[model samples]
Target: MAVTGGRAPNQTDSDGRSELGKALRACRGAFIGVGIMSFMINLLYLNGSLFMLEVYDRVLPSRSVPTLVGLVVLAGGLYVAQGLLELIRSRILVRVGTSLDEALGGRIFESVIRLPLIAGGGGDGLQPLRDLDSVRSFLSGMGPSALFDLPWLPLYLAICFAFHTLLGLAALIGAVILIVITVLTEVLARNPLHEAMGLTVRRNALAAASRRNAEVVVAMGMTGHHTRHWSAVNDDYLAQSRRSSDLIGGLGTAAKVARMMLQSAMLGIGAYLVIHQEATGGIIIAGSILSARALAPVDLAIAHWKSFTAARQSWQRLNKLLMILPRQREVIQLQAPSRQVLVETISLVPPGSQRVVVAEMTFALEAGHGLGIVGPSGSGKSSLARALVGVWQPVRGKVRLDGAALDQWQPDSLGRHIGYLPQDVELFAGSIGQNICRFDPEADSQDIIAAAREAGVHELIVAMANGYDTQIGEGGHILSAGQAQRIALARALYGQPFLIVLDEPNSNLDAEGDEALTRAIRSARERGAVVVVIAHRPVAIEGVDLLLVMKDGRAQTFGPKETILGQILRPPPGPIKIAADGGVAKP
Candidate 1:
């Protein structure tokens, strides 16, 4: 939100020690090296131009026309080469950025995945990470490019000073005055500009979130509501953009004034020198051209900086994601779990929610037991599944894995015992084989096919024209909801785990798909891995050992399904049907 003139004052060196820092440091070096080469090219170009000017004045009348044409061509070649080099330097920036992207991007993902745990769990992440991404992209794209232009001005002034101290003094004064005006205008517009940028980032995040959840908006017939929200936010951003534009225009005016002053200073000083027989018109003309050519990139940088400022905010946001502590660490241990997971007094709070969604929950699942989690929507069935796998840490209690706290179980160790399928099905835009072997890259094709058959997705995969090799579009657009879910189940099955946490595995499944999933769950149980399924419908959880009803953030009852269904979940489908710790049920 500091886009409204707020900035992280102490962030300079704190986040600067990561791979991003190393990449940016390398970028800084590239920028300096490019600037030096650019300066040399510019110097060569000027020398050639000046030579041509001198040739025209002193030798054109007496020289052969062909020789003069050759001189002109050579000078044009220098200018052409200079132009090409500038273009090349800018182009190389894209590659340099790509290289850095590959090396450091995972760290950004890690940061986002980790920081929420540090901030008291998932409730403080989603929005901040979105904002961070915006800032990081803008900054990384073009913010530091100003450095490329910053160097040439001083060097140009020094060159002018070398020829004549008096002329150099005037040039220096003129440049100083220009810089002062630039700084003054920037300061004057600082508050409004920053506020406008903050609003812009906010609006952008809203638009992005809206776009992501567009299906829900459309389904609820809340299109008008969101349209109005987006329009108002967009208008605010537009207004701020106009204000920034106006400030730039005003700065342009100031630059115009500075240029006029420069022109007058050069001419008047040159006239004074000529009258006293101390200087010539040629010197003045050369000085003016050199100065103008030298400041071209500065002028260009000024324009680019206006664009770069917006991008700087974006880069900052993106970099923030890289700073979040990942929910899952990269640590791995070959040692396996010593005991099954035990939960006591656990709670779940989603990012950005004010109330705790699930609270003070306790449970112990003996190895090989299938626990059924039944609840109404918002009763925290999905949250329980995530917490068991340590996706979101419990707010009030510890989840012990293998007789140790979940964190003590090495990062990869939990994965070996734990496989989770969230309520919504997600698939990569790749083949079935790729999705199945995501965790085990070295998994054999036969093993992948076996897991697929176990999940009841092998037949579907065979139906596709490319079979297992067929590409699944984004989120498996080409496949049905049931197919994607089964594929996800297959992926979890591909890697052997001691525990399986499935959130609403039967959610979008047809009667046949549900039966298939139930069979798969039976297989996991037979294999001696504990299975926890977030159940919605009253399907026969025949293979499950015990069922727990979750209501009002606590375990309403712990007993057989027959005991809780009549008491907890089988209540009338109206008025939330309260069954928390024996409250009077609502109809």
Candidate 2:
């Protein structure tokens, strides 16, 4: 059997696009637009240097007011155009980031929800959202602009060469030095940044877990212990962040200093050329400007080195995760389940283990029948219930409903026909009516009331302050355990599902609640829905027509309820005995 539910490694879609490629493709047009705008923006950068050259070479030499005024007008026009292009480029990038988030956010959440059911699917659940945010932040920020402008460095260098060969040589050498600094920044910060990101994810997950279980922690007096544990994790994250920041900050400082010195050195070289009568004063200042422009992209890259590494790592991690998730298949229309469940020697193992939880168990239940599965703790009753409801796929044999395999049916379609109440009932934050209606946007009010009445919670709900409109706090914490379980039962019974599996449905029920549960089961059976209840108490199983006794992951007995109960409760044969005092004796 497969160890986990993960897809094969390196899986791809029909068009052969990897998950990373698919995400990037969504922003391709914006990236290209940014590239074009960068080219225009860099070309306009020459307006300032050229204007300086014109002021020194022509306007000042001729002392002509008209010429200077014309140059000023031209420079203003170029600056205006450059600003407009920059604004457009920024807007496009922002749109690209938003679009990417919109495209992938829902898919990532769905993948997270499905991950636990798949084999080999183990990772921080919230990491994908963070990774997506990382990608979006980088794309919309100044980092991408630096990359877009990097290619123009060569053009700037060529301008310096046009002024004088020695000035060109100085600019080229400075560019090489700054490039080395950028590389060093990456090498030094990569590990520290990666470590810091991991710690942040762990810390966030820990904090969320602690908050979710706050009541228990406070009651158990574990608040101090958890606080100290979280503090240690935070300290580790801070240390790694400090290391990364220190390295990037050092490189940024060095790059800035080197760029300033390089400009000065180019000026010095230009001045020497002018002294030799090989270049003019106008060319000297323009050469220095060009040299600064040439190294600006490299400087920006080094300054934003941390964001680059984080984004790169996030991209890789997201790619690996998305690839491992199974590709969504085309939905096939199938008929609804007809309450005929055939469990043909089905076996179930835990998600990440080979140890069987339900072993080679075979049974069949027809419409209008109720099966009560009674077993000791750890006897696999819950596992069998999960298999029956398609939460856990069988490792061997098959579970067929209406002559079709459970896994073969479309999930949403199948879900509409299956009502499952796990041992631990968890209700989401919503109104009582909304939870009962399964949060369906188009849920009919009549059906909601019918389901509540059938589950025997309608009277209790109408007695509340807002009737069906009462708001339940997160996980239904505001309600008593019995209330939550009854509401959960109402949710399961909604839409009159053809098959219902209730695992320990009455675990938290009082006497009234127990009667309500039994009435619900009988009502469902009357509607010809096959009902399966896993129970520990005899009262909970009293209405069941069939009994299945499980022990040690195997079904010990499966037959009529009276026959099985009689056989189990029958007294063992023994030899008759007499009391030593001659009184009647019991054996």
Q: TM-score winner among the candidates?
A: 2
Give the alpha carbon lDDT tens digit for every residue of 332-413 in model 2. Answer: 5567777588999988897878898889899899999999999899999998998898878888989999878887776767
Report the lDDT tens digits of candidate 1 across residue range 1-587.
11111122123345645434655676776667666766666567476537645675545566677767777788788778877876676666655666566655655555556565455442223544444444345344543444555566777777667646776788777777667766765676566667786776678667777786989999999889998998998898889878877887777676666766676776677667768877655566666665665555555555555655555554555555544442233344435553476887877787545578888888787777888888678787777787888878777898886667776655555676677888878888888899887746677999889888878889888988999889888778888887888899988887667778888787788988888888888888887778888877767365587798878777887876567656754646556655787886656
Cα displacement (Å) at residue 243, model 2? 1.5
Tell me the spans in candidate 2 whose CA falls farther than 4 Å from its real position: 1-10, 119-123, 575-587
What TM-score would each prediction reach against the true structure? 0.79, 0.93
**Per-residue lDDT for 470 in model 2?**
97
Q: What residue pairs are clashing in model 2?
A: 4-119, 4-120, 5-118, 5-119
Assess candidate 2 and give its TM-score to the true structure.
Answer: 0.93
Candidate 1 achieves a global lDDT of 0.69
Strongest candidate by lDDT:
2
In candidate 1 the C-alpha lDDT for residue 548 amounts to 86
Residue 30 miss distance in model 2 (angstroms) = 2.4
